[model samples]
Target: MTQVDKASRKPCIALMGEFSAGKSTLANLLIGSDPLPVQVIATQLPPVWISHGDAPAFRVDLDGNQFAIDLDNLAEAPLDETAYIKIFCDEELLLQCDLLDMPGISDPNMSSEVWQRMISKADGVLWCSHATQAWRQSEAAVWASLPPDLYQRSLLLLTRIDKITSERDRQKLIRRVRAETEGLFLQCLPISLLQATAEQDDYDVWLKSGAEDFAKHLVDLLHSLSEDGAVGPEGQSLPEAAKPLRISGLVAPDSAPAPPPAPAPQTAAPQIMPRRVRLSPSPQDRACARDGAPGRPS
Candidate 1:
């Protein structure tokens, strides 16, 4: 393919994981708004797909005919071999990329075969695994099977990390999880999706949630993956030394953070270190998440 042909094809990043692992939270952060519905909906429904769009939403059936989804009624939609429902949003961040928010791979009711269909189109994934139970044997097995190219583009997110509370415990858990899935993901990031959501506007919230580190890595990775060059197994340019483009975004997940960048022109400052996540529709999970809850703002 010509260099121009390759540059035109935008990368698609899928937010994938078990139910309630905070997949939607990461999506919301990128979209810079609460476009994707975050409810307590569990397994019995269809995929809540997202892409770049002008309107906040429209539901597309298995055949791709666009129809309005109440967004609220996703759980009631038919799921029997009807393909997946597409949810469209107009988030600006999508201008440079596509985000696929997928269904739970571990749901007993859903077949692995179903999620498999979506993998080929995905250039990368942000795999959300719960912090305490980070990488299960099942997750590892599946992640191991993905094309290595995807791994260079993917991020393994350890969600709900606030549970451990202790710095030592958190590091230990992160270390063990990475050791178990070594070479499977480009990088492993631990962040409290819940805290990030509740404290969306706070820089400290983003850093403390560990999202700052993840965001920096994401920007660097996406910039590298978007280029058109012979990719090496190391995820860099082959033969020629790869000088990955430095991508600037509204968010920066850094350690010794600086002032948040101003929106748009003035500074193109990183986004408000947004840490927002909406809860999915769940009976028991909701209770566990909120039992020790903080005031959840929009």
Candidate 2:
């Protein structure tokens, strides 16, 4: 099937994972608001394509027909005939890129076609795996099966890292996953989505949650995709050497000590970081980020 016209579209990043692995949570976190209800997110719904706007919610069927639907009653959308649900949000982050929240790869009640059919619509992915059982065999097999071009630009995020109480065990788990999927992903990072989303105003808590590093890497990745010619027009393929992007100040997973906290921006920055993620003020010449507060100057 033909995907969106890349020549005129923003980069699309897919949120993928097994059921309850924080895919919905990550989506909510990124959008800075919940576009779908928790109950609706938990159901076996199709991919939700979110963009930056106030357009009403709608559904796209397998036959490529469009049907307007009430966002509050997403559960009522016929799953058997739907290809994806389109929801437009006004978050500034959506201005930079689009987010496609996919179904859990491991849902027993859902068919692979539900998500597989939407993969081609993505430019990259944020693969969420539960920290307690990060990177299961099934997940790895599925990830391995994806086109190398797609996987190369994606990041494997170990969601709910806060659940792994022991620092030692957390480090060990990250090490193991990184080694096993060494070259399969751009990077494998651990994060506590709950903490990052809950403690938006507290900078230290947000940084400790690993949201800072993840945000930096994510911004860098998106910038590269847009500026480095990583994503081409409709019919073109990704470049072979477009794998690594410069992630300034990003610490290794095994030794990702939180950087020393800097003072919060004097003013809210652009919404580059997640709704909760705020960076310290940097030189005015450097790129500005979210909440009217700019990110650290490059």
RMSD to the true structure for each prediction, in A, is: 10.5, 8.3
List TM-score per model, in order: 0.70, 0.77
Q: lDDT of all the models against the reference? A: 0.62, 0.72
lDDT (Cα, tens digit) per residue for candidate 1, span 1-298: 3444434455667888887677766676556566534463333555556666765455555576666666666665666654566666664445445677777778887777666766776777999998888888878878777778777778899988999888999999999988987777889888876665455446567558775566567756665656543243333443322222221222422234457655577656645443322222221111111111221111
- Poorest lDDT segment (10 consecutive residues) of candidate 2: 289-298
lDDT of 1: 0.62
lDDT of 2 by residue, 56-148 (tens): 999999999999998888888887899999999777567567899898899899899989989988889999999999999999999988878
The lDDT of model 2 is: 0.72
Model 2 error, position 284 (Å): 10
- What range of 10 consecutive residues in model 1 has the weakest lDDT sum? 283-292
**Stretches > 4 Å off in candidate 1:** 1-8, 38-40, 55-68, 200-205, 229-298
> Model 1, 249: alpha-carbon shift in Å?
11
